[model samples]
Target: MKKIEVFRKDKWNMIHVEIQGKQLVVREISDQWGEDTHIFLSRPALMDWVQERFSAQRFEGSEEERLSIIEKFKEV
Candidate 1:
C-alpha cells in the first residue's frame, strides 16, 4: 500500500488517502475514539469522488505536485 495524502481535519481527527493494489482507500481516524473508518473505491469511482471533492479547492502542495498526485491516482 502507498500513502497518497493525509488531511488533518482537526487536532483529533484525520483522513488518510492511500492506494492498495488497484483500489483507492480512504481511512478516517479519530484520536478520541481510537477507531478508524475505511472506504475503498475503484478507479472510476475514485475519480468521481476526487472531482466532486476537489473541483473548487486547491490542495496543500505546489500546483505541479498536486497535479502529479491526481495523475498518480488516475494511473493507478
Candidate 2:
C-alpha cells in the first residue's frame, strides 16, 4: 500500500477517493491532530466505512453527529 495522494485537500479525507493509482488499497499518513489520516485498504474497506460510519444510522445518533456526517457526505 502506497501513500495516498490528495485529490481534494479539504474533502479528500471525508470520503473514499482514489486517484493516480491502480491499486485499490492505500496506506495513510496523519498529522498530530488526526486530521490527515485516510487509509483506504480496499473497495470493501471504503464501502464498510460508508455503511458503518457515514450511513443513515448516523441520523439515529446525536444531532451533532448526524449533522456532521451529512455535511461531510454533501462534499462528496
Q: Could you estimate the TM-score for every candidate?
A: 0.45, 0.35
Q: Per-residue alpha-carbon lDDT of model 1 for 10-40, expressed as tens digits?
A: 7677656777776678665778776565555
Best by lDDT: 1
In model 1, what is the error at residue 68, expressed in angstroms? 0.6
Give one digit per residue, the lDDT tens place, for model 2 in 11-74. 3233234433544432233333444434554555655655565466553456666556545433
Which candidate gets the maximum TM-score versus the true structure?
1
- Residue 73 CA displacement from its true place in model 1, Å: 0.3
The residue pairs in collision within model 1 are: none
- Candidate 1 accuracy as TM-score: 0.45
lDDT of each: 0.63, 0.44
